[model samples]
Target: MLSNLIRQGIKPTPLIVCAGGTSSRCAADGLWTVDLRARHRQLIINEEREEVEVGTGLTMAEVLQGLQPRGRSIPVGLSTIPGCGFVLTGGIGPLTRSQGLALDHIVGLCGVWGNGNIFDLSAPTNPASPGTASKNETHQQWKGLLGAAPFLAVVTAIRLRTQKLTPLVIWRSVCSVQQLEIAIEAAETWEHSASLQWAWNDNIELFITCCADDPAAMEAMQSLRTHLGYCPESSMAIVAGQHAQPAFGTMARAADPQERIHSEVISRLGPAWGQRLPSLMADLKELMNNRPHAGCQISAQQLGGASAQIPVSRTSFIHRNAIWKPWINATWMACDAKGQESALAWLMRANNLLSDYCPGVHLAQIHPHLSCHHQELNDAFKNWLPGLKHLKSHLDPYGLLPPL
Candidate 1:
C-alpha cells in the first residue's frame, strides 16, 4: 500500500502509524493518514523464552492483558495509550530503573521501510541459529532501530523480552517545595527496584513505587521517606502483583480531558538538572501561577540505574547518561488560537530558564517549532547521525517518513 502511494506520486501529509488518535504528534492538516489500527494485531507468546511477539496496532493495555495470564510483564511508559512508537522511540516507564527502557528489551522487529521494502531485524533465536546477515551488520542495525526506527519505517510487529510479574507498593504524598527537593535528591541514588515521579498541580505530590518482594527496594523506599520527612497526611497503597498502571491512571483521572489541546513540550536531560530541582520548582510555580491555560504544567521523571548503565555507544539513544527528564508543557484549547499563542510563549520562557541546565533532549518530546529540527537530530543521535542519514538515504530516498 505504501509503495502504491509512492508510485502514484502521492505523499501523505504525515504517515501516522497508530491505531488510536491519542498521540499529540499527529498532523492536524495531513492530506492522508495511513492507519495501522487493524493492520497488525496479532500476539504470539514464546513462553520458553519469556518473550512476546506483538503487532504494532496493539495498545499497551492489550499487551499488558496478554502478559498478565502468562505471569510476565514489559516495562512501559506512564500512559497505556501507546503502541509501537513507544518502543521505537525510547520507552521510559516506571520500571525503567530496574528493567531498562522498552527498547532495551526488544529481541526483534519487522517493518516496512520508507521505500516500501520489507525488513526483518531480529536477534538469533539461539547462539547456533543461522542468519543471512553478518553478526556485525545485524548488531549495527539492531542498535539503529532501537531508537531511530520512527524516522525510517512503519513497524509491523515487535518481539519484546518480558520479565516475571511482581508486586508493587506505591506511596503518594503531598510535599512542600523543600521536602520535594529532598525527595529528588534521594531518588538519584535509589535502587533498581524503586522509581519516583513527582508533579506540581496546585499542590506538590510525590509518587514512589517499589517492587515489594525486593528487600533492597523496601529499604530504598524507607530512605526516600526519611529524606522527605514523611507526613501523616500521606496516603499509600500496595498491589500484590501488578504494575504501576493504577497509580498512573489515578494521575490521569485528576487531569481534565479536553477534546482538543494545543501544547508544546520541551524535555531536557542531565544529572545537574536534578541538583537544581529547587530552582526548577520555583520556576514551575511561577509559570503555573501565570499560566494562560488551566492545564499548563511542568513535570519530571527520574532516569538512572540500569538505564544509565547502558552506554551511548551501545545504541542510538544518546542520552543514556541523563539522570532526569524534566519536561515543561503548555496546553490550551485548540480552537482558542490566541490562548494557544500565549501558552506557547509562556512555555518558551520556562524552557529558556531551564535550558542552561539541560545538555540534551529526549526525542519523544521534541517539537519542530520550538527547537531547530536539524539541531534536535544532532543532539539526539550525535555522532550516529551520519550513519543514520546514510541509511535513511538508502531506505527512504524520497523522505516519506518524518524528518529526524
Candidate 2:
C-alpha cells in the first residue's frame, strides 16, 4: 500500500501494523498482525504485581482476561472486541469512573519505528528524558504515543498495571424526554454525592450504572432512583466477559438484536467537556424543529477507584478527571453503501456537537467529521511531535514508511 501510494505521487509515512480490532464498528476496516516480542527480550506477566507486558495486537478484552485470574482489571473503552491497542483514543466503561482511561495503566512499550528500528519507551526518570521507563510515568509516555502513529514506532508490546475486581450496581429506567432532562439534571447533581454513571436518549430514557466498594453506593443509587420516580430493573451486575445490555432497551422491532441505536452524545460526556457541554439534541431540536432523525442518545460508564488517581500526562489518554466518557452514537444495520453513508453522516453531525467543545482521538470508530487538522498525520498527537519526528528521521529517513 505504501509503495503504490508513493508511486501515485502521495507522501509515504510510517504505519504501525495492529491486529485484533476491539471496536469493529468504529475503526478502519481490516487488521494487521504484528510481533509482540519486546525486542530481543522475553515478555513478562507479573500477576503478583498486577501488571502485564503484552503485545499491542492483543484485544482489550484479551488483556482483561489475561489479568482476570489475578483479580486485576484495567480501564478500557466500551468495545473490547477490537484487536488493536488504541484504547487511548477514547475509552469508557463501567470501570472508568474508578480506573481512568485504558491507557492510564501502560507502563512500557516496545515497537518498530518508521526507520524500522525497534525502540522501547517507558516512564522517564528525569523530566528532560520524557521517554524513560518508570511505574507512574507510563501514562504520560502513552499520551505522547498517540497521533505520532508509526513515526515513533509500531507498538509491539505494552506493559500496564491492573486493579482488583469490584461489584457493579446498574439501574435501568425508561422515561419521557422531559423526564429525561429532569433525570439528567438530577444525575449530574448526584454525581458528586453518589459518584454515579448515567445516560439518556432523545426518546427521554435513562440508564445509570454505579460502582463502589461499600453499601453507601447502593444507598446513593436508591436516592437517584427515587428522585427519578421510575422503578428500575435492578441488580444488573456488569462483570468481565458478559455482554452488556443496551442502556435503553429494544428501540424498534426493525432494529437488529445486536444493534442498539443510542446516542453517546446525549447520555455520556467525554473526559474534559462534560460539565458544561452544549447539548447536541438541543441543537437538533432547533434544526429539525420536531423532526427526528431517528433520535440520538448519550450513555455513560463511570471511571473510579485507581482510575481517578492516574495523572493526565501519565498516558496518551488525558481525560483522567472526566466524570464520564460519553459515547455519542446511533445504531443501524444497513449494508448498502448509501445506508452506511447516511448512518455515518448522522453520527458525524451528532458528534460535531463536541467539535467546538473538545478535540477527540479516534478509537473504536474513525471520526469522519474530524477536522483537517485532526486528520493531518501530526495533529493526531499533541506535545510528542518532536520525539516522534526524531524517531522517524532516525528509522525511516529515506521515508519508506507508509503514508496516512
Candidate 3:
C-alpha cells in the first residue's frame, strides 16, 4: 500500500505507526491517514539466539506476554499498549539501567522507506540473521533507523535482543524532596542490575527495583532502602519469579480511565545531568508547589549502565552521557479548552526550566505536529540533524513522514 501510494505521486500524509504520538496529533484536521497496525503483527522468538523479532503492530504488553514463558523479555516502558513506535524513538522503564533502552535492544529492522523502497537491515552480528553492513550506505541506515525510523520510513518489523527474565524486587515510598535527592545520588553508584525511578504528583513517589538474586545488586538495593528509611514490611514488592512486567504493575499508578492524557517524555540529554539533578530539587519543589493543576506532574526514569557504554554515533539517540530522563506531564479534562491551554503552557515553562542544564533533548515522543516539534528537532539531534536531513531527503524526500 505504501509503495503504491508513493509510486502514484501521493504521500500518505504521514505513515501512521504510532511510537507514542497522541491521538489528536494523528487525527489532525482528519487528513488522509493510513494506519498499518495490522500489516505486521508477527512475533518470532529465536530462543537459541535469545532475540525477539516483533512486528510493528504488537504492543509492548503483547511482547512481554510472549517472552514471559520463554524466560526472556525486553526493556519496555510504562503502559505497554503502544505499538513499535514506542521503541523507535526511545523506550525507558524500570529495567533501563539494567537492560538499557528498548531501542538499544533492537538488533535489526525491516521497513519501507518513504520513497516506496523496501530495506531489511538484519543484525549481521546475530548468528541467526542473514546480513552484514559491508557497504557504507547500509551501515549508515542501520544507525539512522535505530533512533529516527518513524520519521524516515515505514518500519514493518524489528529484531530485539531480549534479556533474561529474572526475579525483581521492587520498593516504593512517598519521599520528601530531600530523601529523593539522597536516593538519586545513591542510585548513580548502584550496579547495572539495580535501578531507580521517581514521579512527582500530589506527592513525590520513588521506586527502586533490583534483580535481587544477584548478591551485589541486592546489597545496593538494601543500602538505598536503609538510607531512605523505608518500612520494609510495607514498601517492598518481591516478584521472585517474574520479569519486569509483574513488578512494575505493583508500582505503577493507575490513570483514571475517563480523563484524557496528553504528555511528552523528555530530558536534557547531556553529560553529568544526574550530578546536577539534586541541585535543582529545591527549585523543583517550589515549581511543584505552584503547578498549574493537580494533573500536571513530573516523572523520570534513570538511564546509564549498559546504555551509556554504547557509542553515541552508533544511533541517533546521541546523548549517551545522560543519566536521567526527567520529564514534565500536563493533563486536563477532555472538554476543557482553557484547562488544556494552561496545562500546555506549564509544560513549556517546565521545559525551559531544565533546558539550560543540558545541551540536547530526547524526542521521547515524536511531536512533529506540535509547536515544540521544531525546537525539539533542532535540539534533539543538534549537529546530527543536518546529516539526518540529508538521509531523509534520500529516503523520504516527498515529505511523507514526520520532520527530522
lDDT scores of the candidates, listed in order: 0.73, 0.48, 0.73
Q: Across residues 241-340, which tens digit of lDDT does each residue of candidate 3 receive?
A: 3334333323324354356655544555654556577667866787788777666778777778878877777788888888777777777777777887
* Residue ranges of candidate 1 with Cα displaced over 4 Å: 1-9, 124-138, 226-233, 240-244, 249-260, 272-275, 369-371
TM-score of each model, paired residue for residue: 0.89, 0.69, 0.89
Q: What local lDDT score does residue 9 receive in model 2, on the 0 to 100 scale?
A: 35
| Candidate 2: segments with Cα more than 4 A from true spot | 1-16, 23-44, 84-90, 125-143, 146-151, 187-205, 232-254, 257-281, 284-312, 319-321, 330-335, 359-364, 367-404
lDDT of 1 by residue, 1-404 (tens): 65566545545534655544455665446556566667788989999999999988888878888898888988877777777677778888777887788888888899777787777888644433445566755666667788888777777889999989887778878777778777777777665678878766556667778777778888888877776674875767777454444554234225565567767776767774555667776876777789787677777777778888776766778888877777776788978889888988887787667666666767875454454566667767888899888878877777777776
| Candidate order by decreasing lDDT | 1, 3, 2
Higher-ranked by TM-score: 2 or 3:
3
For model 2, how does the per-residue alpha-carbon lDDT over 1-404 read when each residue is reduced to its tens digit? Answer: 32243234322222224455333322233422233322222335786777778766567666767666666666554455654445534455655555555566666667654544455776454434434355334433344564234433456667777666554555655554455555545554443323444444433335555554546656766776677664443434543321332433332122434544332222223443334434644664443332233443444444445555765444444444445444555544545455445555665665565444434433334332344324433323445445545545655566644333
Model 3 has how many clashing residue pairs?
1
- The whole-model C-alpha lDDT of candidate 3 against the native structure comes to 0.73
